[model samples]
Target: MAAAWHRLWPVLALGTALLLAGCDEIGLKSSLSPQPRPASLRVVPPTPVAPSAQSLDLARYYHKVQNDLLTRGLLRTDGGGPDTPYSADDLARNFEKIVFYNEYSSGDGLSPAQRLQSGQLSRWSGPVRIGTEFGASVPPDQRSRDQAQIDHYAGRLARITGHAIAPVRNGANFHVLVVGEDDRDFLRRRLQQVIPGIGPAELDLFSNLPRSYYCLVIAVSGAHNPNDYTRAVALIRTEHPDLVRLSCVHEELAQGLGLSNDSPYARPSIFNDDDEFALLTSHDELLLKMLYDPRLKQGMTADQARPLTTAIARELMGQQPQDPI
Candidate 1:
């Protein structure tokens, strides 16, 4: 009996040891055991890139322009400085009553009153025409393609802003010429002949006439015969003081016709928070930044952002009594 008991104890002890090993493998442990080391989690931060020098220059230019305008009383400030950021709602609200006209044909011709009021057209006259001079050195195909892009943007501007943009033809009401070349020196020399201070870096020229029509000329500083190519426009508004006061292409088109230049903000519904997001993110830079923001990941789509932004701009601008110039 003593020999049998001794043999049974060895077998029982072996079974207990096997069971304990199995429990450790399955992560089962008594409170008396030491805690296992936790798995380390790694998180990555976003990379930062500095803006280009040209972009910084542009920002400075915009700041200076705003300051100058404010000093001249051309822009109003409600306690905020001229550099105050504006929301899409502000723009929309300010210019809600403004009207926009597109050059679309209706079944009926102009009425008698409409015909008489033609001269009173304050903003735009007709379709916009853009002329390109390919210069002797440039390939005709490239020139044509560039002109096509300009035409496309013109049409887009008209359609989006509901403004009348004249087509490019010999008798077009307004003409904008874009000249391009690969050589900067040649382009500068050509533009300098027309406007003494013209430089290679400054390629865009704008002129607003008394008839409420604006003419834009863009010189491509990089092509062959850059001078002759750049001076495609024979009549330049060299002496107009207001030529320098025109806003950017988009802003000019909107303000020229007395409409709000707020971006198109579209959303399914206008909830208060959505409205706030739209207004705060109207600026192009801010909008671009918010595109990748994690907070907005579940908030809105890119398409939805524009409409919301526009509504906010309108709200911020609201209506103000304009003193006639």
Candidate 2:
């Protein structure tokens, strides 16, 4: 399956809805409005409670969901191979679409629009501190596994972007909440603190997220500088199986770093909505590296960054196109 790795791209936020052309079997493509918990900075476990009927049902549903995706050979983790070989042009084009455009309308902040609109580049201009909180129903083992994966991923992100990124317990602006159906109230209370003055419409997502949305992330920037993300929150549904949950982590957390949109042409990568890759691929790593390359400043438009992206992609791919740039 070298055409590409399998993916399960979830709606990370208002940042972008890259594409909704495919992968609806699991509804992997989303255009929700956004998160940060690199992992377990405080590790506060919710009060233990019996699993509610909704929680149990959700668990079963997600169990079947992951099974179906696997059966279809989706969520591939191999990164990609010869059959999925891509050119520098492919990289640059995908980068332009994913990094410079967004899915959904920001005008309403609540409506999920299926439109692809141009947007400025957004990313963390400062250190990214991630912390995690889990619901009571989450077992200790699951917590440990999720935290370990996030920590490892945080390190990997820092290495890839040459930026300061880490999972912390204190002073975390990025909060990752792992909750289930039973934790709706807990999540509601927490969301108030995590996102002050959140609107009722957006509130519905955290308190009563739809089954269609497997996971979600919200990356927010200060009013003075929308390109510089200051805070984020990602909701990973505990109902999902381990692989799906981790896939949510990978896509959402990375999306929090500013790759907000999904592109259909982005093969050999998780940036596509094809559900072909479960993990970030070698192709995606180059996008991250190029994103934080220092030359592409925050708030850059697609046109402003195109030349640089092409150069970066060419260098990363070691390919020279016959056509002039």
Candidate 3:
């Protein structure tokens, strides 16, 4: 029994040594292996830049001017005001405004600032023909309405002035274009082809025109006579609000016929920039009559035309005129 016990003791000692060796190897590998940490969830913000002082001041000035125009009844949000009727006395008062304001030419590299301030009347010396061209994108209904309005206004103008104003499909010196704002690029290209010596400034004006300018009329004076308009271009926005489109149609077309500039003093008329009186009023009709009167010839200066204008206004009002000084 003593011999068997000594043999078993040797085996037990060897097994204990093997188990301890395996434990040490496992402990070394666990200590040496890498452990990954959870990634950090953080965010960083951008630094803000300050606006230029000039830009801030300009923004203020721009808003201030618009507000002033609003206060003076010169600019209206309701697309001008209702055409409140005015008496004959008001027509006399507005007559001078019409004659002087429409007497200046603004084409062929001539700026509005460069126009003659003399009381000369500017008008078409020759017969007037209006031709309308519509953008391909303009809706058919809109095109039809625009044409009807053009024809209607042309007749009205002719009757008022007793002038040979007619609507022609071809060879018209007065071109009326109806286009959407999105089609301005196409209009620019077409204009370059149609108008002789179309300048970059004109194209730029059309391309960069403010959205507020729903319509505009550009007239070119005759080369021989600065006061005689030889060509006129009228543009009307096709995709505007109904009243705005119609108002533009009335204003731009009439303006093309020589009552060009806007007069804040001219009440009950579409010739004022105030957007008051969307349609051509009776007062405007009388002014047109006065403009095309035989006595008031084209190219008469503002100073030369006032007396005659006053005379015409008095006659229209059925009032006796004072003798000219």
Q: Estimate each model's TM-score.
A: 0.27, 0.85, 0.68
TM-score winner among the candidates? 2
Candidate 3: where are CA atoms >4 Å away?
1-93, 101-116
Q: Residue-wise lDDT of candidate 3 within 196-257, one digit each (tens)?
A: 55556657766665543455565555545555666666677655545555666776666666
Ranking under TM-score, best-scoring first? 2, 3, 1
Candidate 1 residue lDDT tens string, 146-191: 4564466457555543434534534332223222222223334444
Report the poorest 10 consecutive residues by lDDT, candidate 3.
Answer: 19-28
At residue 77, give the lDDT of candidate 2: 90
For candidate 3, give the lDDT. Answer: 0.55
Q: Which lDDT tens digits does candidate 2 get at residues 230-312?
A: 77788888878898888888888888887877777999877776677888899999889988988889978898888878887
The root-mean-square deviation over C-alpha atoms between each candidate and the true structure, in angstroms, is: 33.8, 5.6, 35.7
Scanning candidate 2 in windows of ten residues, the lowest lDDT window is 20-29
Q: Candidate 1, TM-score vs. the true structure?
A: 0.27
On the 0 to 100 scale, the lDDT of residue 204 in model 3 is 73
lDDT of all predictions, in order shown? 0.26, 0.72, 0.55
